[model samples]
Target chain A: MKTLVSYDIVEDKVRRKVFEACKDYGLTNVQYSLFFGDMTHNRREELFQRLRRIIGRQEGKVLICPVCDKDLRLSKAIEVSAGMPEEAAEAAVSYPGRSRKKARAG
Target chain B: MKTLVSYDIVEDKVRRKVFEACKDYGLTNVQYSLFFGDMTHNRREELFQRLRRIIGRQEGKVLICPVCDKDLRLSKAIEVSAGMPEEAAEAAVSYPGRSRKKARAG
Candidate 1:
């Protein structure tokens, strides 16, 4: 299934762990706290379980959603970084940790 | 079409204006910088143009995407505020600006 995971984590450390978990699951980091990609039902469940454990007693929320191709086609993404000086800044803004990287599955 | 809009604006003022525009378009505040709801192609284009103009000469990025019912069903939202005191805090974190009121949508 094509899943979209988004979260609002308070603690910086906790948030980092969540990001790592998403990355480990082969999900693409689309935004600061938003991840997107495909995952098997078992993988999604495993991720949810891990995220639940990781988020224990933390003041935060993690949302995992699905995205079909039909809706995704209608999707729009607008990125404006023309004001930045270096090309790296735009890449950094667009993809948080994968700047200058070739690409990953999304 | 079912549309999803997300933005990362630099200036607080410009960000607020963009938020107002999204709210004016009847989009639901699903996250801090994400909005979701149904909108015509024309409306989406209009929003894109307005956001583009608002973010001119500024460091920001606004993305508008689509979400269909099939994908929406597989979505999961988990909120952890059991340790927090007062109901308003949860409301504030989950849905900013629209606290203690009936929800517009998801």
Candidate 2:
């Protein structure tokens, strides 16, 4: 499944930790406080737990939204200037599984 | 369906318009540039179009992620000190339909 993770943290140290954690999970940074990635159900759960530990009981917030591949394909992302990275834009538009197969075939 | 809308805009005027558009759709502001709301599939589509119009060809980004109620219930939201508004927190944890019924019964 594709997931969109967004966060807002006040503490600088904690915020950096959170960013590193997201990257550690192989997630793509779409924006400053936003990330997107493809992960299995189990992996998603694990990522959530890791984030919770990093966040602890601090003054911050994280929202993990599970986006359906169908909805994602139907969704439109318009970039005026140099918006998201190529990889992030690809993740948003294409189904990861299918795209991986295409990559292999090519 | 529950939707998590997140945005990052460089222009002040466009950002304010996007914020107001989300509120007009009866969405709750979870953070400065993030919002959460419940809407039907059709309404969600309409909201998307409106956001696109507001964004136009500018240096802004908007991501609307649809969240399943079941997944939302399983999701955990922890607030340290005044994290999210009470309403936003409730939306994250409970099934909207069941919660509405409970409210009526009570």
Candidate 3:
């Protein structure tokens, strides 16, 4: 399932560690401090545990939520400045699952 | 339906406007740049259009996605530093819908 991870960490060092951990867990950083990716239930739980350990009752906060595929399909991304290249946007709107390559190319 | 909204804008003024707009739409700030709330399909679309206008091909980015209630049930929040009050957390874990009062009180 796809999961959404959003975090707010006051401490810079800990925040960086969490960011790296999320990346290692195969999530894509869609925005600063926001990540999303697909992973299995077991892996999601493992990631959650690892995150908990790293955060460890400090002064930061993390929220992890699963997002269904239907929701993802209905998701909207708008780039105000320099909207994505025409072809790239079309690819994304048409075949989101296959748009990664087009995105990379664009 | 519950919706997740995430934004990243280089311009401070525009970003602040977007933030205020989100609050006006009844979305709660979950993080500095992330907001989530429940709204109907029409309202979500209206908000999207308004956001698009505010952003207007500028150099900012926004993402909006619907989140199912079931997903919210499985969602997890961890606070590293000062965890929520025991009662508040328990309330959220037990009856999330009714935890708003407890959270506000705490």
TM-score of chain A of each: 0.75, 0.73, 0.74
Give one digit per residue, the lDDT tens place, for model 2 in B1-106: 7777778888999989999998999999986688888877787778877876776666777776666666565444434445655554333332232454553342
Best by lDDT: 3
| Cα lDDT tens digits for candidate 2, A31-92 | 66888888787887788778767866667777666666665654444344447555543333
Query: Which regions of candidate 2 deviate over 4 angstroms?
Result: A82-106, B82-106
Candidate 1 lDDT over A51-93, as tens digits, reads 8778777777876766676665555554666456444333322
Clashing pairs in 2: none
Could you list the CA RMSD of all candidates, in the order they appear? 7.3, 6.6, 5.2
The CAPRI-style docking tier of model 1 reads acceptable
**What tens digits encode model 1's per-residue C-alpha lDDT throughout B1-106?**
6677877787899999999999999998877777878899899888977776777667777767666665555555556775755443333222222232433242
Estimate TM-scores for all models: 0.73, 0.71, 0.78
Q: Which candidate has the highest DockQ of all?
A: 3
The model with the greater DockQ, 1 or 3, is: 3
Stretches of candidate 1 exceeding 4 Å from the true structure: A82-106, B82-106
In candidate 3 chain A, where is summed lDDT lowest over 10 consecutive residues?
Answer: A89-98
lDDT by residue (B1-106, candidate 3, tens digit) is 8898888887888899899999999999977788989988788778877877776656777878888877776676665446665443333322122354553453
* Lowest-sum lDDT 10-residue window in model 1 chain A: A91-100
List the lowest-lDDT window of 10 residues for candidate 1 chain B. Answer: B91-100
Q: Order of candidates by DockQ, top first?
A: 3, 1, 2
